[model samples]
Target: MKVTITSIELKGPFKFFALSYRAMHILRQLKATNCLAMKKRGYWIKHYTMTLWKSEQDLKKFAMSGAHLAAMKASKSLAKEIRTITYEADSLPDWPTAEIMLKKAHVIHY
Candidate 1:
């Protein structure tokens, strides 16, 4: 399986509502894209996602298209910081495990 974990800190509280709208689209698309499992955590300015897929290809297919694509385009503008990690795994990590991995992962400061 392939696991992807992402963490985003919005620039401000207001950005959460904006991102939430886009997130709705992403959730709908995720189901259709054959994601094996997914989880989200955090509140207000902070948000995170841990997703499981059969392969990297399946994950990329959902990420690079649809509302997710739009969200990516808005990321630099909407978020204060973003962190991401992708790796081959036997299963999706729990929120705490994902958070631990994210600490050493790539980060973008907006």
Candidate 2:
């Protein structure tokens, strides 16, 4: 199976609890509409979000879909900003669990 992972790095100071809540909201919203898996980590207030998609088309569809587009646009308006890079994996490879997915994703960026 193919997996598309999105790695996001937040640009400013953001309360962890608040961002986590927002992340959950975003993930739930995406999961309701598409096949999506999400994870997050931090570094000096910088944060990373990894979203797994079944395919590039699936990923694109969610990105261009109305609610997602609105949420992403709204995120930019917040004091914190984020940069994301999407990666394609032909297979899960060495990842045995979702945790592995997060570790592998952390090692990859555009």
Candidate 3:
């Protein structure tokens, strides 16, 4: 499976609800796709998500279109920082392991 982890730190407390609204849209879209599993955790001003897919191509396909694409574009302003990591995995790991991988993920600047 292709496992991807993403984390976001908001610029202000006010932005969390905005991000949550967008997240809801994306999560709704996710159900119609080929994604295997999805999970999320939040702490303070940060939010994290983990997703499982059949391949990186499948993941990219979802990202490059529709509500997700719009949310990603909007997130640049709503987030103080955003980071993501992608790798192969035989099975989904527990949230603790996923959080560690997210912590080690490279930062992305938009």
The candidate scoring highest on lDDT is 1
**Tens digit of lDDT per residue, candidate 2, span 1-110?**
23544334444455555556666766666777556455556656556555666787877777776656765665654424444445666443332354345454434222
Q: Model 3, range 1-110, lDDT digits (tens) per residue?
A: 89888989998888988998998899889999999988888877889888899988899999999889998889888888899998999677787887788778988765
Q: Clashing residue pairs, candidate 3?
A: none
Better of 1 and 2 by lDDT: 1
Checking candidate 1 for backbone clashes, the offending pairs are none
Q: Write the per-residue lDDT of candidate 1 for residues 2-103, one digit (tens) a residue.
A: 999999999999998888898998898887888988999779899999898998888888899998999999898899999999999988877778899999
- Over 4 Å off, model 1: none
Q: Residue 99 in candidate 3 has what lDDT?
A: 76
Clashes of each: 0, 0, 0
Using TM-score as the measure, name the better of candidate 1 and candidate 3.
1
lDDT of prediction 3: 0.87
Which residue runs of candidate 2 sit more than 4 Å off their true CA positions?
1-18, 33-36, 79-81, 91-110
After superposition, the stretches of candidate 3 with alpha carbons farther than 4 Å from their true spots are none
> Candidate 3: TM-score?
0.91
Local distance difference test scores for all models:
0.90, 0.55, 0.87
